[model samples]
Target: MSIHSYQTALVTGASSGIGAACVRMLSRHDMRVTAMDRDSDRLAELASETGCEAIVMDIRQTEELYETFADRDIDVLVNNAGLAHGLAEGFLGTGNDQVDEMIGVNVTAAIHVLRAVLPSMITRKRGHIIAMGSIASLYPLGLPVYGASKGAIRSLSRHLRMELSGTKIRHTEICPGRTETGFFDTAFGDPQQRASFVSEIRLLDPADIADAIEYALRTPLHVNVSSIEITPVDQVPGGQILG
Candidate 1:
């Protein structure tokens, strides 16, 4: 898909997985891409491979984040940096630090980045904001905290779209089901546990979601795709409630 409409884009969590895929796809479309991630090495590699600018910094660092993109005239903002402790851990089991980290990165960080970039878009009166949500947010899930974070994203996207009504700016939420990424490593820690959890379920690749983002961005300025939920063909959410 051609992103000729957009001249520049900023993608968070761009070192790997869906974020990295977005960097590659946007670059292919000839958009000037700014890839951001905490991993300096991986960010450099991605920049080299895709010919995009790299910002090696944690999204949680609000001050630095603002400074990094101060002079950038971004046309698209992809909020994709997020993490979870594990499905087995309930809200209390996850502890304070992990909970803070999840909220900080998933919700707060996105807000900060938007705050920095939206002014430019509003001034230009044209831009697209793509947020990465999860199917877990759509239904009651075992991963309570993670689901809540994504749910916040859903609400944020909806409200932002409403606030930007009658303007050229657009907001879209891409909610994806199980995707193969390092998320499992951070959540489960042990390799065996991660394998066992995903062993039975069909996992979607990062590229799949990246393709969805491309489609959303490629749509005409008059067309706004509000939200899209994508899941692996073999995996479906169960509706039964266990007592």
Candidate 2:
């Protein structure tokens, strides 16, 4: 697709991190983006920097998602909002609250958002949906909920593509390995753990993932890149814990 082929895009989690990166990259291509996130200030900052519209939204609230996108014509929908909480205490030790939160945000919320936007895309016969899954999706990790949530997204991406087979809509799943982000510190809840986990390899900059997103969106309308797995050159393909 040409840089200007897509006039507008809707990106969830478009405040900081990967979502913010995507907004910045897409704006450079001159696409009008509807950037939404829970962080109103950061979302505003992103919009100001990218010349895109910003809306403060929490995807966990399915009704709010519908209200936000009801009247919009979206050319691309990037489902990128998600979270991970370590279940180091064992399955029950992980606690039901954390599990519910992950499922609500990663799996349930994604379906609601997709359902709300897909009809318009189908009616218009033009759109692309990209989900930000993780390398953990390919194989289960010790963090059961985190891996399973992403696993759901990975499968959702494929099934969506199959369902939209003959339509102009396209679905792409991006599975990126560990990166230098607040995710490690926040998820693990230990600064020391963050260092231990990430010290093995250089991290991929958020801009790199953003570039991949832009590329997938910019691919010619006829050529749909269904899936992408990107990691640092030093990063292994699977099981980051392997010796």
Candidate 3:
């Protein structure tokens, strides 16, 4: 029995990394895809390569989100666009703009997109929401604001599942750890730091997270994979010790 039931999927941050991988994977499954990203050039390139509908717009612009998805009927929504501006000194160390940007893109924008897309799904009673979370959400790593944003996603996914319990709608949180997506390049200010971190450990690829998402989505309608926390085999958290 085949469980590939979705017809259309919308993936945010689809220009690169996990989002791009999801676009490609979903397309390979014969699902129509709408790829959204702020990077117009990369979005166009991805669309050309994968035959997806590309939308060039920043997710932080909430007003535009409603207008962009006004009439689209999306079966799967992958909230993958997020940013972590340097983890130098946690939340208090960063400027207000950086904090706002992280919260806006990582948390608020997802809610806006959900508001815009959920009505049709609720009306039809069939949809799946995939939230891109991080291991930081579960295991704190000095980046307070980034962790908080992902924790918000983790909480949102849990509550959303409860809110839509009787309906056919499903929610999943994909929490990935230390992915080799060049995300650390933006998260760390020093090039040497990024290089050193990359060399120090084996990181999970974006495709790994995308594969997990694909599996969750392709499950039978009766089965709901609520959450998946994936990390490289080489990486594991140690127990906290009392000093």
Question: In the order shown, what is each candidate's alpha-carbon RMSD?
Answer: 1.9, 2.0, 2.3
**79-160 per-residue lDDT for model 2 (tens digits):** 8888888734545667689889889988999899899888889998989999999988875566778889999999888888
Worst 10 residues of 2 by lDDT: 234-243
Off by over 4 Å in 1: 1-4, 240-243
lDDT, candidate 1, 1-243, per-residue tens: 456478999999999999999999999988899998999999989988999998888899999988877888999899889898855567777878988999999999989999999988888898899999998788776888898999999999888888898778988999998898888888885678788877766788999999999889888888999999998887677754320
TM-score of candidate 3 against the unseen true structure: 0.95
| Model 3 spans > 4 angstroms off | 1-3, 240-243
Q: What overall lDDT goes with each candidate model?
A: 0.87, 0.82, 0.86
List TM-scores for all candidates, in order: 0.95, 0.93, 0.95
Error of 3 at 118 (Å): 0.8
Query: Model 3, 149-214: lDDT tens per residue?
Result: 999999998888888988889888998888888577777777887787777778888999989998
Count clashing residue pairs in model 1: 0
Error of 2 at 20 (Å): 0.5
| lDDT-based ranking | 1, 3, 2
**Candidate 3, overall lDDT?**
0.86
